[model samples]
Each structure stands twice: as C-alpha cells, then as structure tokens.
Target: MTPEERSLRARLAAHVSWAATPDPASRTAKARAAADSKFEREAREMHPDASDEHIARVAKHLRSAHFSRMALKAAARRRNSATPKAA
Candidate 1:
C-alpha cells in the first residue's frame, strides 16, 4: 500500500480497537440483566408451583452462576490474548 493509505489504515484500526472495548460497568449490567431474564424464564418453566421465597432464592443463585460464568470467560480471553499467533 501507499504510505498515506497505510497511515490512514493504521489510524482507523487503532480507533476501531479503542471504540470496541466495552465499558465494564455496562457490560456487567447487561450480563446481569440477561441472566435475570434467563433465570425468570427457566424458573417459570421448571417450577411453576414454587413459592415466592424459593423463586427468589433460585433466581439469585442462577444469576450469580451466570455472572460467574461470564467473568470466567472474560478472564480466559484476557489470559489467551497475550499468546503468540500461529504463523
């Protein structure tokens, strides 16, 4: 590529990379919301006869598990990001 074109491409890549890094608070909140909805749906399906207190406890447990899974996935990405790529 021409020097000017290469420079422009580099700048664009940097900008895109910076823009794509999610806000941690927003990401966590979104994950939690998704987990909450998922828990509600599954609880409703599997425990139609469950009481309010039991449902609350089950929902909390399920959401926490989902959040923890998300966290572990994020950690794995961070851990693997530094590895060298295959040629």
Candidate 2:
C-alpha cells in the first residue's frame, strides 16, 4: 500500500500488457494474403494484357522468393545464436 509498491505494480502491469500484445510486424496468414494480393495487383499493372494464369504464376514466384529470403534469414539467425560468444 506504500507509494513504492504502487509504482512497482504499475510498472509490472505495463510490462505485462506489452508482452501480451502480438508483434505488429510478425508474419501471419492474413499478412501473407495481403502481400500476395499486392503483388498480383502490381503484376497486373505491369502486364495489363497478360492472362490470369500468367499473373498468378508471377505472384507465386514473388511469394516463393519472399519466403526463401525469410527462410535464409531465419537460418542465419539460428546459426548466429548457436555460436559461442567471446568473453
């Protein structure tokens, strides 16, 4: 019930609130769908006369490339984390 106790409780509550919130930048199905849609729109704009199949192929290629890069980065991070740090 002291002032210091109240301050500590407020800090803990703030930290918990932050930790409970999902990361805004984390990838999710919805985010991936949005990205796919954006890529398809861009492809359409670039090749207005292209067939739907071609546009879909282009979007698939773009999405695969994006995922490949993400995988590579994740692998690199895992390797780095596994390495022993110099004292």
Candidate 3:
C-alpha cells in the first residue's frame, strides 16, 4: 500500500487488460489461423491412416515449430537492427 506499489499494480493491470483483448480481423491473426489449418491439412495428408489424436499431435508440433522459427528470425532481426552498422 505504498504509493509506488499502487502505481505499479495499476500499470500492470492496465497492461494485462489491454493484452487480453482479441482482434480476430488482424492480418497476423488471420495468417496464424491459416497456417494452423494448413499444418493440420498437411498432417492429415501425410498420415491418412493415422488416428485423430495422432494427427492433432502432428499438427500441434508443426505449428509450434513454425512459430518458434519465426520467433528466432524476429529476434535475429531485432539484434541486427540494434547493432551499429559499418560506415
């Protein structure tokens, strides 16, 4: 109940509220959905005889791998941008 603690709590609450808002129409959101569907389809095609559980697992793995790769690339881009460029 210190003033500084209250301010921090308010800012954190605001951030959490803002972050929880969903935007289904955003391009990135749509792209992510499309990618997820594509992964599921690809998994199904690759293992036509597999059980639903297996296919779902494969699709989940594919989506996770894809996003992890994207995150790595984004981090690399940020690192490169922050580095001083040679004249």
Candidate 4:
C-alpha cells in the first residue's frame, strides 16, 4: 500500500478525524495573508531589488505553472484510464 494510504489507515484506526475546512472568505483571507507573509519573509532572497509588482508577477506565474502541471497530470491519468490494459 502507498504511504499515504497507510498513514490514512493509521489515522482512521487512531480515531483521528480532525480536518479544518474554512469558508470561502476565510480561505481567501488565509491565502492572501500567507502570500503576503511569505513575500515579506523571502523578499531579500526572492530579489534584493525586486519591486512589489515583480513579486506579484512571479507569484502569479508560479501559481499558473502549478495549476497547469496539475491539469496535465489529470489529463494524463484520464487518457491512461481510457486505454485498454495489456495482459
């Protein structure tokens, strides 16, 4: 079994079911706050002379890249699932 599956099973056996699902507004707020915090923390390393707009653009590019990669993975999974399995 996968490690995640094992971990999930262990969590289940341990009777640990504590997942936090924030509201839309709360989620947006949390995401914005986290982005701001991260930008501030890594400002010097991200770019000693980078402006706020540059940082924002970089963040946007990263987000888009991640989303595109995930979409490609999902599409690949669907394509593989549709093909006939070899014996």
TM-score of each: 0.54, 0.55, 0.59, 0.54
Model 4 misplaced stretches (Cα beyond 4 Å) = 1-23, 31-46
Task: Compose the digit string of candidate 1's lDDT tens values, residues 1-87.
Answer: 999999999999988876886775674788778767889777767788999778878888877887899999999998899788899
Residue-level lDDT tens digits of model 2 in 1-87: 999999999999988977886974563668877888998998898789999999999878877888999999999999999999999
Sliding window of 10 residues with minimal summed lDDT for model 2: 23-32
Q: Which stretches of candidate 1 lie over 4 Å from their true place?
A: 1-38
In candidate 2 the C-alpha lDDT for residue 55 amounts to: 98
TM-score of 4: 0.54
Relative to the true structure, how large is the alpha-carbon lDDT of every model?
0.83, 0.87, 0.90, 0.73
- Counting clashing residue pairs in each candidate, in order, gives 0, 0, 0, 0
Q: Candidate 3, residues 1-87: lDDT per residue as tens digits?
A: 999999999999988876876853573787878888899999999899999999999999988888999999999999999999999
Among all candidates shown, the one with the greatest TM-score: 3
Tens digits of per-residue lDDT, candidate 4, 1-87, equal: 999999989988655433444455664798878866665556546676888777777666666676799999999999999999999
Model 3 lDDT, full chain set: 0.90
Ranking by lDDT: 3, 2, 1, 4
Winning candidate number (lDDT)? 3
At residue 59, candidate 2 shows an lDDT of 79
Candidate 1, 80: how far from true, in Å? Answer: 1.4
Task: Give the least accurate 10-residue stretch of model 3, judged by summed lDDT.
Answer: 21-30
| Candidate 1 C-alpha error for residue 17, in Å | 20
